[model samples]
Target: MSSRFRLFDRTAVMGSGYIFAMVNRMQMLYYILILPKHLVQPYMIVGILGVGVLSQINLFILAKYLTSNYFVLGYRGFVQLFSEKIVRFFALLGIFFILIKVIVTTLGYVEIVHQFMFPSMKTSWLIFVLMASGFYIASQGMEKTIRLSIISFLATIWVILVYIPYFLPPISEIHHLYPLVPGEVSLHSWYGLLMVWSALSGPEYLVCLGPWIGPKEKILRGMSIGNALSVFEYLVLFVACLLYYGSPYLEKISFPVVNMIRYLQSPVFERVDLILISLNMIYFLYLIALFLLCLYGAIRIVAGRINIKTNRKGFLGSVAAVFICMLIINGWYWREG
Candidate 1:
């Protein structure tokens, strides 16, 4: 029966390269799109760097857990660390966390598509399309979903190069980057730093992929490379925002990174921003699929069905429940602040 639905089956071990791709793509999720508006000061660059260093330290600790003997045992590892009841309790808590993350990420990206790509379209339809894509990818099972990380990374990584024009002369203003250090600090500045820290998250979730990722020794090195590249990307985007819009003007613009992309005048394509925004769907789908699988697994664990075979009805019902939750939130509660 388990062989019939091999969602959690591990046939071959993926290397450190997969780990690198997954970590980098996960950290560079939806938050990066609107980060510049929140971090509206030049000195916040320092905050990014500082938070990045702290994230690296956090990854080091995570590496220890990933490489541990117990991790290779998967669910039994948690059972050994705590008891079966405690593990189930954690899984129960995880269901809520996974749902929240999935809801925010899917709806956030849907809002972008609604505003920019399809202003006339209903946001609920956009959410359904995106969630359906995610469900398809996740249904392929964990190994293939993990493999999608590299494709997601390759597809969106070049979008950063498009921002190069913002950093050059003519478009860039020298004074915008002035006062590299903050003149005065406030609680708002601390909040901006906290955002950076939050952005560097998602790597810790790699603990769940122990059966697929290897060799154990290379895990930390791969994670470090991915983490470093994410920081570098953040620095480039934030600096380009500063140079293009300056600190004062940057605060007023929503989706500064996407807006910067809109300024690029391609001779062939009139709406280059739309094309790139669509390209972003690849990674966004990868994340949603990854989280969807994680959510389902957590559900099974909490339900004490970890040893049972996966069935189409159970999986589809779970995905449908999430889709319904997203619709309810979009219809009632989700308001951009």
Candidate 2:
């Protein structure tokens, strides 16, 4: 007998812990790896905190929607609110957004892996291997894919502690954090604030997972904690970068966080940075899998087949289409920003 493909099947309602893990991990995507280089000014530390507060307020509004009776209804809830036609239209728009996110995120990480981990390897093979891993994880169904979030969180969160050495004397300079206030603000400073806001944006996507997320009362608490943690991680990272490289030197580094990891020396492990990068893959794969599943669901909704039984061919075809798009963009359009 052939197995049935049920991409959105929800066997269990996940608690706030899952929500917390997912939100935290989503906010800490590939962008966080390169954020410090963009917001190199020490005064931008204030931007990080300010944007984090704004993100919290936004999450408050989002929590209202998530807690409503309509939210748990999932697709039907959206249909009731916007009508089937409008919901379909929204799903249509979602397809493009999801595609761009998956493409950019996957390709960005592939470039990192290519540059840092395997410079000798072709980028195309790296993309294939990563997507295949994601496809296999996503094939397990939404619940399992979501359950992987906690694992992803735990596996990589400890890496933050590795940066502690950067905070101490020999590697760090007290004067590097001086002049924490900006004397004259410019367009570049505002741009840095916007980047910080953008970095904290992944929680908004949680609105779509209403059916799986639970304990409506605790949703806000979970999300708030997650958002707070993301900000703290951002602060820790940016400060460490400043202490280690200072604002002027930080501006020149491409991947400041990854480069900082390279500075550490371990007796047993020849390449500690490589090990951390590999561990980072757990969350990267988790997110790619989650988005792949989301993309397939969006495709189904757009095709007016939300109720239809999912088949392997349709699912594989959607993933393949995305893979091809990645290949095309990587080959022709992708440029290092």
Give each model's whole-structure lDDT. 0.90, 0.90
Candidate 2 runs further than 4 Å off: 1-3
List model 2 lDDT by residue over 42-158, tens digit each. 888888999999999999999999999999989899998889989889998988888988898899888888889999999999999999999999988888999999999999899
Q: State TM-scores per candidate.
A: 0.98, 0.98
lDDT of 1 by residue, 18-126 (tens): 8999999989988888898889999888889888999999999999999998888888898999998999999888889889888988988998888789999989899
- Candidate 2 has which clashing residue pairs, if any? none
Q: Global CA lDDT of candidate 1, please?
A: 0.90
Clashes of 2: 0
